[model samples]
Target: MLQRLKLLEHINPGAAHRNVADSIPPPQLHKMSLPYNKVLVLGATSGIGLAYAEKIVEDGKKAIVVGRRKENLDAFVEKHGKDKAEAITFDITQVGTIPNFVEDITKRHPDLDCVLLNSGIQRGFDFAQPETVDLDVLDLELTTNYIAHVHLTQAFLPHLQKQSKQTALVYTSSGLALVPSVKRLNYCASKAALHHFLLCLREQMKDGPGNVKVIEIFPPAVQTELHDEKHQPDIKNGRQMGMPLDEFTAESWAKLVQGDDQIAVGMADRLFALFENTRQQQFQKMVEMMKGH
Candidate 1:
């Protein structure tokens, strides 16, 4: 009877590794296909977005970089040359105009296959101090960081979905989603929501024609214009902030070319590993740390 019980246990549905094999999705086979010869990068004025655009052009891919600043866009076009790169002025927060803008872009560049939604803003706030946290500023941050991204994705989805092959939606999220930071409530919330949205979208597209690939980039604090110049001294004293702009770009470009779904840079990669190893413990620790700051 004992021997029979052992045999039954092996056949039970609750057996540990029984469901594991079924749960695994087949690995994507066609990895080398470049979604398109041309790509669109939003928020190309500065920071990681601009850096990425430059890398794309350097790799000999035609990249159209968009930003709100006309002069900055023109400068990028001039520096990169009209053949390899183009620049357009766009404000993603202007939701009403997004559909028209997307239509115009698609008409002009019918071959465009990849869209990178990389525009975002970060602001520190003291929820406890009303004077320090302006409602309008908070609202703007949320709108630009989260709402604009969702709208732009929606506007471009049909175009992306209709593509023949290798189409992708790439988003610039943050490490804050994995671990919370103090005084950045709005930024953290926006990034966390974006991360969840992308994850759900990825799952939904699983059984489809592999028409759309969702990629998320989680970067740690980087040396950029996001912080106030006046607060440079304070930031320097606190901790080692992000890496140099060029260095970060180089690493990010190499990873993207290799077709990584999730790219974590610098110390941010450590946070990713921590979450995978001890999700509950790390989450609690993060909550505790945020409460004190």
Candidate 2:
């Protein structure tokens, strides 16, 4: 545990303050209202997106979950009750179709003010074996993880700005965005791109009368079905290294409602500062050591 903390202490100095259980939202929502009450969660059929939607529903809010599979969407909408949760079966990677899709949603649910860009793909790459690699895979990760979200954001931002109510534009960037992983180079790059994109989006929306708020959730490793069977060994190894999905999501929701603009789950912040500080080199060395181990 000390070893784990050592690698990340530079970024997670406030780790001791992570135990604020009393900060959880009460049954009656006695505190401030969350800006994301009526949110559209992209890639919401599984993993972190689904978890966020479920949490929103549990908080007595509405979530419009967008996914690629109609079957999964149907099942989720059926189980969650149509009132609290709605499903939009659409592939986020289909960036060109998003503008029309957004227009439809704006017409159908004018009250929808938040868009959580949570849909992404995580895939590994080998630079050495360029011939064996499918370069098209790179496109998939970049488009699905970063580019599609940008398209969706652009499509919705204008409408969100016009709304009188508060609006939130949330993003789910990974810990790897800060500290790159050796294997998933493209995935890390995509997430890093998203992190920067969100930063710029926030800056641009700064003078917009506080009606539009941007939030970035930097998540460390968690138990999510983001990877496939080939990545199982790596996933199993990294699974023990992260907080449980339930714990991560619970803390994330509470902190978000508490009005945190940039929320890093558990030890995720520790890694977030790596690129700026000299600790980046130290982190790289640690990564090499881990590979050796």
Candidate 3:
């Protein structure tokens, strides 16, 4: 017993004095509300992001769409009308400017109750042929998908917390977060990182003073440009693959409105069940055991 304590102390410095329980509560499943009014969705130019932006507007919420493509943003604004939707052109990959970007957005839209980090890219990399892989692509994919979101979360959390009403930080992760896709290895890994990050974020904020809800949408391959051959060489006719865009959008919106913190759509629903039933159980059990130490 003494040796085990010494080992544990060595593994985790100051384990005896530090209380993990105080830092994070034990896992509990609870229905979460999506009562956000003004929502800022990053990467809302096309695909799932754009779909969700449209839904937000349709649901009588103000949608602030941000994307790199000015034309697409303009079109979205024109279609939705200025009263319902607004657009901003910004590339999330420019990580250094995120703090200033957040400051400007919050200043302009003080009532912004939700910020959705949904920018992502899918690419194929063959590690077996190391020379064939493009390190630049890998860096860009990881930066846009994971690192940028981390920075955005850090920048936006304070703003969201200051809001008198409930606020939410939404992430569009992938079903691949749970089940690895061989073709899009880095994409899977990025979403997996995001999935774990959301888990920790939710647990920490569950009982905290902040009325912030961490919501994640796990999407299966919908008919989106993500798998286009132009982007992912290994994938062709990818736009025709998976669920229909409208169908996915409608189903996902229903789930979001139903107050599910972890919204999983289509095939992603099966993976989510597996995660909740197996992995989540084990994770909660581990947390329970840690309370004893």
Q: Output the lDDT of residue 85, model 2.
A: 85
Instruction: Name the better of 2 and 3 by lDDT.
Output: 3
- Flag regions of model 2 displaced more than 4 Å: 1-33, 230-241, 272-293
Residue 173, model 3: lDDT of 93
* RMSD, every candidate, angstroms: 14.3, 15.0, 18.9
Q: What TM-score, over all chains together, does every model reach?
A: 0.79, 0.79, 0.86
**lDDT winner among the candidates?**
3
Of candidates 3 and 1, the better by TM-score: 3
Superposed on all Cα atoms, model 1 deviates from the true structure by an RMSD in Å of 14.3
lDDT of 1 at 241: 56
> How far in Å is the alpha carbon of 140 misplaced in model 2?
0.6
Model 2 TM-score, 2 decimals? 0.79
For model 1, residues 10-66, the per-residue Cα lDDT tens digits are 788345436667879999886343345788999989888888887778767888999
Score candidate 1 by lDDT.
0.81
lDDT of 3 by residue, 1-293 (tens): 88887898899878856776778977897644348889999999999999999888877889999999999999999998999999999999999999999999999999999998899998999999999899999999999999999999999999888888778999999989988988689989999999999988987777766799999998889999988989876777999999999998888888887878988887889876755558887877876777646
Q: In candidate 2, residue 89 scores what lDDT?
A: 88
TM-score of 3: 0.86
